[model samples]
Target: MKIRKIAFLITFLFLWRGVMAQENSSSLAFSAYTDVYYSYFSNEMEPNALQPFTTVSPRSERFGLNVAQIGLAYDSQFVRANLILHWGDIAKATWSEEYNNVQEANLGFKLANGWWIDAGFFATHIGTESFLPKNDFLSSTAVATYNEPFYQAGAKLTYEGSDDFYTEFWVLNGYNRFLDNNNAKSIGVLFSYNFSENTSLTYTNLLGTESAEGSAVKQYRIYQNLYLNTVLTERLILIVGGDVGTQSNSKLPNMEETAIMYNALTTLRYLFTDKWSVTGRAEVFNDRHGFISGLIPTQNSGMQGLELWGLTLGIEYKPDPNSYIRGEARFLDLDDNAALFSGSYSRHKRWELMVTMGYQLDRVFGF
Candidate 1:
């Protein structure tokens, strides 16, 4: 099975290369990259240690076709269509066989009235890439966020008639469940207003989900985002955002007493020169599930504990528009004198570090 899959991928790659090599008037395109990384852990424990205890090795490498974006685009009036295929995370093994895992094809049509309609498994239209968190390079070491990443398999519409206001709505599969009838359904909405070039505000909401256990619980989220461009001249930009949400019957056990998760983050980006820039970010998470708040477990199936905070520090390097790299280090303390979420006997501390690199090529071929 592995050999057949690899052979098929190679054949597709070569055929794509030949097609791009053609001197025709088509807008099809492709690009790919590799991520090589190493990470270390402090106070890490074995898999059976307890809640928040996970295994970490000295070195691990993940490789795959990073991004293969293809589309039919025309630049004349108000008409465009894009079909993007992100060859993502082929080595995860467990999640590689998902029906929605293969390709993300988006069909978009823009109208002259500033209204657009898009249907496909496209990149999420939510706040920050954090909404569709990329954990390949920087896994969720400590803190947990309310939003999950890249919700496809639905239709989204956006309206941008005015310079100050824009709104987007999407009806999609709640999480990444693909098109399974057993999975929950979800609706996502985004609203943003730009008072000026230097300032803006935005909000996002995600709701309606049913667990595989037939739990009719729902999740809701709200975010407030602020951006200031003139903190000290036009070279510095400051971003501050907060997200709060309710997750009933979370995938995490012993913390599912209708747990609530909220996060606060602040970042400062300074452009020392036109080609070089620096960014510093600090984040904190407050997770109060059940036991940490001193609430007794309702039954043997109820939650038993709590987690207070997690921190992240990262720096990014962007030499040009086509490439960027970021390194992130984070530490999480899962101490509340609580029992293991898995009904185990022990609990441990965890720390994680990760790095990521991304590049975009506009037109990689010469016709």
Candidate 2:
């Protein structure tokens, strides 16, 4: 009788364990997405040291397949993690012709009391997307800038208590602008407040040092970005914002001042249909002071100060929840005394036409 009772208890516990496992499997969720791009860029004049002219062609240099990032993420009430993999060399070559063996990865978790923590390699959460504004195209904008483009490995934490407010802080492997595993490191903090459903504001700060050519220099950089968003009606959305940044401690062989670069942009988006949308933007930039030795000063003999303006008009079409295509025409004009163009001595301007196709995957390998 005693032996039989023990056997019955064991069987009951085994059945209970099996049921719990099945329930856990049902609650787990997984998702993934990928984006492939081809880019062609051209400038009126050849590039200089600040902006190198390494492309073989003048009017158009077709940089190979930019990159297709495969993202895998898994989530549950208690934990989560994300992984991003790329096509290696093709992506590395486009970043810098010298470096190889490149990949990006990130890992994150949730803590008690609405605390979120993450660590690994990732891009800074800065600015709105330059194109395809509706999609969460965070990393893509980094690609267009060609600066701080890839993931910087480190740790980040966030506190999101309510729908109206949140704050985040991060320490990263400083602006690996292009490649990875450089000795530079930095720290950043961002605070945000959502005024309403259609409006939000953000403040950010970053500080670090960078290595260039054959030497390394310490740098103190500060930036503040303000974003104002509103829904004009059921069909229109507007976002007006600007950024001001100043950098000190550059390694320029001969110079005494830090440079100040700032930009302002106004963007408008209108939805004509559920699948079609129209967008426009006007942006201006100023680079009056060149990065001198340890001080901030005006430019030298040539057009030292640069001022440029950009205008963009585009249409976005979303065929499904997972895919989108967009076409845009960009026009740029530099000030008569700006260093980017020689319009003061000659009559010339630079322009570009771009088209983008992006896709988001819902599942990978039926997982």
Candidate 3:
């Protein structure tokens, strides 16, 4: 009788556990990611030693960790949430100074007709390139992408109906900020359309005040971003992107007319095999007034704003669906007397080499 009673108790507990597991089965997942790389620069003493508008692998001529992130996501019939935290060179260089470690912490709810409302910090929908190497064709970002926003704190309304188009409207603290730099707010929108499974275009714009609270200058900025992704052949991919922006004249000590800047780039990736691919990019940036790139200081006074272009070629080897090893060589040149960098080490041209390895843990629950 004692043995029978023990067996019955065990069976009852197993049934109860199965019922609880079924009842709590929701789309919850844990994700982790990391990338490490080695990069070298031609002029180690130049001011571009800050890596010249870069985040990943900012350490030159040495091995470094680009970024390491871990997060949790949950989605259900009515609600969803995401929380991601990161550390490494990417976070230190570009993330918000106050909330530097928080990559994303957002919550959302489903609304009528494929619409959703979300609030909190988010990766900006503005740029053509990504900081994550695996997400982009190249290991390093273009100079144009470096000037674009990387992160934002905001509330957004997103619409993704049955049509091929998707749109998002945002109200935010300010451009590229997690903390409100001033009392004023910013707004923006993004529109994306998919012509086919292999082709799409995205357009984005931002209107906001970038000046700090106590600063002497008060500037209102209007920025536009656009990009397209398409496959010219089964083995070849192409991307073209551009950015144009203008700011209201803030009458300062050196007042002037409205300031304007533009950037453009095109990238191509050719796949030689299922596991091998080569990617190349050409890019240019023009900021005539030094509004964005700043005036290149000559021996005495400030010269023209930056006018620069660059070329990059990279090869990638994918060992699996979630891991990649990449090698790239890049060349950057400044035109005319607009030499870049500072101090006694100004340079008109330089070369860079980088090799990176990346992996993602798509789902590793309770680990």
TM-score of each: 0.64, 0.71, 0.87
Better of 2 and 3 by lDDT: 3
Backbone clashes under 3 angstroms, per model: 6, 7, 0
Residue-level lDDT tens digits of model 1 in 80-197: 4455443333223212256534445666677658788777665545433232122222232223332333445777788979898989888876554456344556787888887777
The sequence of per-residue lDDT tens digits that candidate 2 reaches over residues 1-367 is 9999999999999998888765444222334334443333445344321112111111333323334556566655456667655552234433434323234456667787779898766655555433222353222221123222234567889897789988989787665443434565677787888888877877665666544434545455555556677787999888777766667753234334565667677778888998898888777766555331112222243435445677777788889967777766656666654334332333224555555566666553311
- Higher-scoring candidate on TM-score, 1 or 2: 2
lDDT comparison, 1 vs 2, better candidate: 2
Better of 2 and 3 by TM-score: 3
Candidate 2 has which clashing residue pairs, if any? 255-293, 256-293, 256-295, 257-295, 257-296, 258-295, 258-296
Error of 2 at 59 (Å): 8.8
Residue 165 of model 2 has an lDDT of 88
Off by over 4 Å in 3: 1-25, 46-49, 214-217, 250-256, 299-304, 342-346, 364-367
Model 2, residue 45: C-alpha shift (Å): 8.3
Q: Pick the candidate with the highest lDDT.
A: 3
Give the candidates in order of lDDT, highest first. Answer: 3, 2, 1
lDDT (Cα, tens digit) per residue for candidate 3, span 112-193? 7689999999999788888677689887998777778889998999997857899999999988888888999999999999
